[model samples]
Target: MSYAEINGLSLYFEGHGSGPGEPLVLLHGGFGAGETFAPVLPALAEQRRVVLVDLQGHGRTADIDRPLRPELMADDIAGLIKHLGLGRADVMGYSLGADVALRTAIQHPELVHRLVVVSTPARRDGWFPEVVAAMDRMSAEAAEPMKQAPVHELYAQLAPRPQDWPVLVGKIAELKKQDYDWTSEVATLTAPTMLVFADADAVRPAHAVEFYALLGGGEHDAGWDGSDRPAARLAILPGATHYDILHSPLLARMVVPFLDAPA
Candidate 1:
């Protein structure tokens, strides 16, 4: 376990597994921390060094005065990497974390060798209307009700001050209200990327194809000799959805090989 002073916040990270292979950084979704990947962490760490980081205001990392923004959170990740002396590492993030990974690759290209963006899209509108509506309903009022839910229970058990849950909820709701579009920036990213989503995820299937095409994928079929394949890949796992797909066993099967592949 370690805490690095990054971008004015004490970033919390824990290193899992030890080996001589490439390092992999795992970033979790909103309302979650590193332990959110608990189901797959050991399996992944078996293949490479997995660094789990809790984004600002989550897990052991205390919330700051500023609201959450992808660009700012991406900076925090880059600073932590430099602090840990991992010049370049494979980055994988789920949902909210995926947005941060995309921004990291966009703003600090040199810090990331490969990126795995799971359950995320290039634009805010890519999310289905139902998902957007649910997010819109998130507010301080729901914080009390959420305490009976697993995410809040996890926070209550782990947060520095469990009583701050309402404040966190209000801040997250405010952050989600902001609009963003990263399509042009995503096209310019130099690092290879993999887009992974569940067959029944919050994002529509068309948007996944759209995201991949921006990274030079899904435009055409590789020749029989395999000469025209794009560096990036896209996977939509069957029998999975936005909420539980992160822990699905298939997630490892789809993600690990890409991380292990040559650039």
Candidate 2:
């Protein structure tokens, strides 16, 4: 466990595996923390140094009282990288984390060597307004019950794992009010990229397709293959939902090669 003061916020993070390999940073989604990558860590750590971060208003960090946007979150990651004296590293972002990765690669190109975005749309404008609206409604509905119910009950309702209910609920409650718009900022990325999609995911695959089109270029395939060309690439995991892909070995196989490619 470690914390870094970056841009007026103390960001919580952790690292695993030994050095002498390329560094890989992992960012989680909204209402999640660095531990969201727990399932994927052992494999990734075998050959790469894995850095995991909990974005502001989540995990062990104190909220910096700023609006949540991709740029700001990206800056937090960039600052942590610089502060830790790391060279350019590969970045793996999921959902809200993916948005941060997109923004980081675009705005702080020198900080990231490669990029992977999963379960998140390419363009902010492409996200379903209905999903966002539903999220708002769910949050509103959760408020009163949340006040009266034990945090564990909420976790039993949401997470597959049951040990860290208080932390999860607290993070969810805090980040619920956050919002961001990234439509204009995504085109600036120059890193080699991969956009992974879960076909059964509620998030639109078209968003990932359009995003891959924007970030250099990549192929969109509904099948799973580890090989992709230089510019950019896309792959869809058939029958995998957003949460399902997190634990999928197929997703790991598809992703590792792209980030491990010769630079």
Candidate 3:
């Protein structure tokens, strides 16, 4: 367990394994901590150092007075990389964390060598109507019944102030209600990026293709010799949904090769 003071937040991170190339920095989804990746962490760390981070208000990192915004959280990640003296690193994130990862690559491309965005959309509208409606329904009241859920249980065990669980829940609810669109930013991103999604995801499938297109992928087929492929890549994993994709072993299977590819 290590904590770095970045952007006025005491960001918590754990390091595992060690190999070559830039370290892999992982950001977990909302209501989760670095432990969220426990199921696949070993596979991801086998070939490189993996840095698992608890984003603002999650895990052991206490919340501050600021709202849970991706842009601000991105700055914290970039600051953390610099603070750790990692000059540049590969970043992978899921769901809410994916939003921060995308923004980090966009806003701090020089600090990111490779980016993996999992189970998130480029725009708020890219999500299915049902998902958006669910976000609208998120509230402290709605979170009451969820105290028995694993996410809340983990919070109770690891959070600095377990009583703040409802506060975190309300903050997330407010964060989800905010709007954002990063299509233009994504289209201009310079980092090598891979967009990962579950076949059954909260994001619409068409939007995934559009997200890939913004990254200059899926516009054409690779030649027989494989020279026409774009720098960006896309994968929709089988038998997975947004809820369970992070735990699927296939997530590591798909991510490893992409991160291992030569830059």
Candidate 4:
């Protein structure tokens, strides 16, 4: 366990494994913590130093008076890499974390060596209409019903003040409503990238292919030897959904190789 004082927040993170290869930083989704990757951490850490980050307002990290923007969180990640003396790292994030990871690579390309984005779209409108509708309804009023979520239990156990759960919910709701389109940044992204998502994720399947095309992927068939293939990889896990993809072993299987591959 460690705390990196970056910007105005004391970001929390934990180191796993001490094996060879570049360190891989793992970021969890909204309302989730480093523990969100708990099941696969051991496997991912087997051959790479995995740093699990708890984004601001999640887990042990306390919230400040700021909007929960991916760009801001990405900055915190960039600072964290510097503070930890890692120089550069391979970053992988799920859902909300995926948005932050994308921003990290875009905002500070020098700080990220490679990226694995899981279950998130390049544009805000990439989500299905139903998902958008659900997000639209996210509010403090839903806090009581949300207690059944695992995130609530974890927050209750680790948050400095459990009663402030509604605050986190409100911030996330506001963030969900905020419009953002990173198509330009993503189209020009310089980092080697891999996109992972469930076949039945909240994002539109066609948009996934489009995102890959922007990254110079899914355009040409790799040679029999894979010598002509682009560096980017796109995997849509079968029989998986956005909700359970994080805990899926398949996620670790796909992520480990991409982060370990030489660019």
Candidate 4 residue-wise lDDT, 73-93, digit = tens: 999999999998999999999
User: Could you say which candidate leads in lDDT?
Assistant: 3
- Alpha-carbon lDDT, every model: 0.90, 0.73, 0.94, 0.90
In model 3, the Cα lDDT at residue 163 comes to 93
Best by TM-score: 3
Compared with the true structure, what per-residue lDDT tens digits does model 1 show for residues 185-243?
99998998999999999998988899999999978989899889999999999999999
Ranking by TM-score: 3, 1, 4, 2
Tell me the spans in candidate 1 whose CA falls farther than 4 Å from its real position: none
Judge candidate 2 at residue 68 and give its lDDT: 61
Residue pairs with backbone overlap in model 2: 218-232
User: Cα deviation in Å at residue 230, candidate 2?
Assistant: 4.2
User: Taking the tens digit of each residue's C-alpha lDDT, what string does model 2 give over 1-263?
Assistant: 78898999878889899655679889988766677787888877888788898786665665655766667899999998898888798888998898888888888999998889888875434556776665555543354455454333433443433444444444454444456555455566678888888887757767766666676455454346644544677788887888667887778888888777776
Model 4 TM-score relative to the real fold: 0.97
The RMSD of every model to the true structure, in order and in angstroms, is: 0.9, 5.3, 0.8, 1.0
Model 3 over residues 1-263: C-alpha lDDT tens digits? Answer: 79999878899998999988569999999999999999989999998999999999999999999999999999999999998899899999999999999999999999999999999999999999999999988887867888989999999999999999989999999999998899999999999999999999999999999999999998998899989999998999989999999878789998999999987
Provide the TM-score for each candidate, comma-separated.
0.98, 0.80, 0.98, 0.97
lDDT of 1: 0.90
Off by over 4 Å in 3: none
Worst 10 residues of 1 by lDDT: 153-162
